[model samples]
Target: MQLKNKKVLVTGAEGFIGSHLVERLVELGAEVTAFTLYNSFNSWGWLDTLDEKYKKHMEVFTGDARDENSVRKAVEDKDIVFHLAALIAIPYSYYAPASYVDTNVKGTLNVLQACRDFMIEKMIHTSTSEVYGTAKYVPIDEEHPLQGQSPYSASKIAADMMAESYYRSFKTPVAIMRPFNTYGPRQSARAVIPTIISQILSGAKEIQLGSLLPTRDFNYVKDTVEGFIQVAENDKTIGTIMNIGTGKEISIGHLTEKIIGLIGRDVKISCQEERLRPEKSEVNRLCACNKKVSEITNWKPKYTLDEGLKETIDWIEKNIHYFKSDIYNV
Candidate 1:
């Protein structure tokens, strides 16, 4: 399907992946509506960081996703929807599991319901590798058994099932686009990439981190964004779940060493207790099965881990002031 001149709605347009997605949609000449979580400051989150020209092209809709009226209004008259809004921090999810349920599960219900009602052409529902938990097997595929090791993953699992149900029960056009460990500029401190980058950017001699043994399949944010668009553009992906990832795994310990090398840091690594997840909750390893996505859509990761990390480091170096390196984010 062609994307140019189409009207698209991107929920979570103020977030790291969402913001880049909005910019990409704009570049592709799509008429974009940006759905951002409303705040007292009237801030648009990372979308506020975008240049005026690109930001001007977006119709910013400030609303809570859990509110059906707000979400329904945003869905009205949109040809396609990219549902990316969620409460994504796993540690924070442990504190407020109900919030994750309300936003991730209930909010996704709203999106699916709206699409069913309006018969939207495409709905790309975002999923995460976390739902697979610790990989029981290498290259976890779409058929891999989902293990909700945390509240965040549980909520996402609920959301994903909701999307699938709509397709099976009501024939809603939906694509489950699961991304594995996306990292890039504008990412929040709650994520490992930014946490390490922030500390290095702050010139800390001691780098605090959690369990460094967990492994992940990392995808560059730009590649992640492109994968989303490509999935949406293909009719063959409807009612299917696909993973976006580079089929490569890196341990956190090794990742930290790489970061230290890239940042030229001689810092001593310190394992902070608060930074660690429960052993049962930690995903010990994850390497994605990207064959499903490649078979249906022209989606592929375009950056090597080192290349992506270098770009992320450069961004953090310049935006060091935006981070609170003195405290643990979550």
Candidate 2:
């Protein structure tokens, strides 16, 4: 299960976490293929920002993951496949639930089928903390009941189940990696961390946010990527779902204040109705129990919340031009 000299295909390799994983895989000496959403402009999303040295060890394949043919082509001849491609924005999912199903669920089906056909060694399917919805208990474990409160969470639930079924029915080597709130460089402004950092960096005296009460277990991008690799390299992880997180929780309001302190700014918080999720759809709290991943792999979060936020703030400050801080990014 060693990754060295192995062939790995990462769907959504152009994304924040995916790009970082690709860089890590290259560093591990794995032959990497980056499956990005197709675009006329040939943009590789955040992958374009990777150093050319890392890009030399990787192949970029532009294709829609929902397309079975495209997915098959990308999965072909690969030893392992990490399925990360999906429509992940929760707010956008409310506006277009059908698109979320098509991209998240069906896109995952395409990957699963291709893996079954190709007989891939391992398939690391990405899941989210959103599927757990509001925690019924503190420090939620893998045994926690799943409650899909949003269209995005529902779609991901479907995708995770589909991956599990593949492992059971077809004996596909699949490991579901559910990461709790990962944040770092190249993360979209739609995510809370980026939203807060971008706004503060943009010199906003007032920060617009939704619910401040909801608590989340945030993991740094590098740690999450390592979790993915560790899960994939461990044969014991097959047919199991593992949670990757810091196992610490933070309320959005408190998290905002921390970011403001890091930026050394005095800002007032404004509750924006448009940014709020529907009452039932909002997940009130999430805290991860990393017992499964810790037992299965040599993976644990290295960066503390303050440490990660500092890195994110530094990156956002230098890349403020990429964000429209005044607008609420859906």
Query: What C-alpha root-mean-square deviation, in Å, does candidate 2 show against the real structure?
Result: 0.7
At residue 177, candidate 2 shows an lDDT of 97
Clashes of 2: 0
lDDT of each: 0.93, 0.94
Q: Which parts of model 2 have CA positions greater than 4 angstroms off? A: none
lDDT by residue for model 2 (280-327), tens: 999999999999899889688999988999999988888889999999
Give the range of the ten consecutive residues with the poorest summed lDDT in model 1: 293-302
Candidate 1 ranges beyond 4 A from true positions: none
Deviation of model 2 at 101, angstroms: 0.7
